[model samples]
Target: MHSRRHPIRNAILVIVGFVALAGEVGAADLVAPSVQKTLEASFSAKGQATLARLAQDKTQGLCTHYATSPIPAKVVTEITAMGFATIKYPADGEYLGDWQRGEQIAQSGLGKQSSDDVEKPAGGNCYACHELTKAEIAHGNLGPSLYHYGKLHGDNDVVKKYTWGKIYNAEAFTACSSMPRFGHKGILTAAQMKDLMSLLFDPRSPVNQ
Candidate 1:
């Protein structure tokens, strides 16, 4: 017995298939000269959000250039090296700060907008991408659950340095990482970075407990 296929369902499937194909074609054509000109004309710099921010760095440029395909191994190495070069270590050889302040900084999602005050401190907004503590139920899962960060990775020189580097410039450790280069881009202060380090390293921090 031949089962009858639903014509409406088949039609919908065909439409969806064409839409997907169109989307792929659109993606490939998005970087065309006309699109670039439109984008350039559409945006204007405001406050700290300068027009220069729209310009991609070498790593970003490579990522954009290879958006439709796999990035070459040589290009990946180049990007990783470029990202690594941006990292700046602490001057006084200190890597920790108040976990209490760190918690505040991580939880608060503020600063770095055109409307925001440039003098004010920017937030890490850690909660937006990670689950730091069991107490905080409201959190996103874009990144790994760092609930027992310090407990999992013991407080040591190597661990501390690695954590700092990761926060400072995530692409330095993982090429094309979504995490912002907070320290490298001057988005977060040294003190703020140290506080975040404490949040991740201090045994007493909520991240550990």
Candidate 2:
């Protein structure tokens, strides 16, 4: 005897198939101009944050495209090169600083918001995405756990330069890293970055312990 097909099951299957197809079709479509217009109308410039934040630079545009689809090798190379080239190394030629100060900078998550005082210095916010010291139990792990970073790697020239560059602009190493461009974007001052570096590399620092 032949089994009879349920009409409700058939209808549900058809609806699911149509939904999947519509999703695929919608994936390639650009964001609606109306949405952009709405954002522009709603968002007001405040303090350090400005309307220019809405505009995507070359790297940002490429990153956005890569999120939706595969980015070409040449584009990735170009983006990385651009990021690397833009790094502004410390003019005084000092790379390390007080680990205590660095720890404070890394732990503090203040500055750059509209509510924050623009005159005050910005924080590194490194602890937000990395595990720096054993003492700090409240740390995120979006990036690798950086505890004992210098102990494991040793304070070699290569390690020092790479650490500096990574903190300066994470995108220089990774095309679409979630880590902020701390130094390049002026999120943290050179002195603040040096302090964070010390926190990472200093043998006396709690991170090394």
Candidate 3:
């Protein structure tokens, strides 16, 4: 006499058993190359989204390989060093811009996509992965909420620099973070970054309030 498993649990167990039979790592190695090739062949380039998007850079390749596994200490060091080296601080001493404009940037989800207009400047799309403001009920929970970020962490020079660097290259702080390299990749302009900074750190900003 044994307890019965739920339908979904049974389905998952079957899949796990199949993977175990195939040898987990071995199956991944055998199928990944074919899957990558198929993806490359099937996906078409459009607008600013070129076929090069399929190509994995050094960091991307490493991250993808370790997606389901714990990264080695040496590899973590290497990845963070690579990411940190790419960060470029603002030439102008100013770190904060208009918070009102920052709010708009946070709300905007426009950026590089197949159908998007190439001429238009891409947005930060911050809210898509973060809970930024109390006023904006529609927000994602993928990343930690930055509501009262400035209040929680005082606006000091150290905090400012660290914030700027994190926004620039998230991988610099956390290896294999899903956050985009907005500043490092030139996805956002210096002025735009400053505005976003204000959105995060300004006392008057809705995020801080």
Candidate 4:
């Protein structure tokens, strides 16, 4: 009588082989220079947006270089220092603006598109990732929910500074935060950031509710 092999064991061996093959394929894909060339050929600069956008900045390039692992402590410190140096605080020392306008900005997902007018201001699109208000049911969980932000942390000076830094350059807090570096990348103006702060901290704002 022949000994029969277990079907489950056979299946597991096949799966392992497939996984190893996929890993090899993925490694080969990264080595293909034509991939970058194809991407470059596909995208053309239009309006305020340029082909240069395809190129990563220093911080971005560094992050990409260390994608498979945690960034080194020294590099993290350097990046944070560079980001912190770029922050421009309000001249009058005011850090809060109209929460109502902020709500509108957060809700509106318009601006910064290739067809959009560059002369006009941009929207924050904060609601795209954060659940700011209890009324808004639709939100992505890419970032942590900021609902009751002020209620939980209070509007203290330390909290205010941390909020500003986080908004200005999220990478300042988390080395690889998915949250857009709104202020640091010039995605949002300082005034717009102040308005967002009000929305996060204002007692009357639905975020606080």
Highest TM-score, which number? 3
TM-score of predicted model 3? 0.83
Clashing pairs in 3: none
> Which pairs in model 4 have colliding backbones?
none
Error of 2 at 141 (Å): 1.1
* lDDT for residue 44 in candidate 4, whole number 0-100: 82
- Per-residue lDDT tens digits for candidate 1, residues 54-126, read 5556566556555555767876787788888888889999999999999999998889889988788989999
Residues 3-115 of candidate 3: C-alpha lDDT, one tens digit per residue: 47664444334433433344423323422454556556666888889977766666766665565558889879988999999999988788999899999988888878788
Q: Please list all clashing residue pairs in model 1, or write none if there are none.
A: none
Query: How many clashes (backbone atoms < 3 Å, residues ≥3 apart in a chain or on different chains) does model 1 have?
Result: 0
Q: How many residue pairs clash in all the candidates, one count each?
A: 0, 0, 0, 0
**Global lDDT scores for all candidate models:** 0.78, 0.77, 0.80, 0.76
Candidate 2 lDDT for residue 90: 76
Rank ordering of all candidates by TM-score, starting from the highest = 3, 1, 2, 4
lDDT of 3: 0.80
Q: After superposition, how far is residue 145 of candidate 4 from its true place, in Å?
A: 0.5
Better of 1 and 3 by TM-score: 3
Displacement of residue 201 (Cα, Å) in model 3 is: 1.1
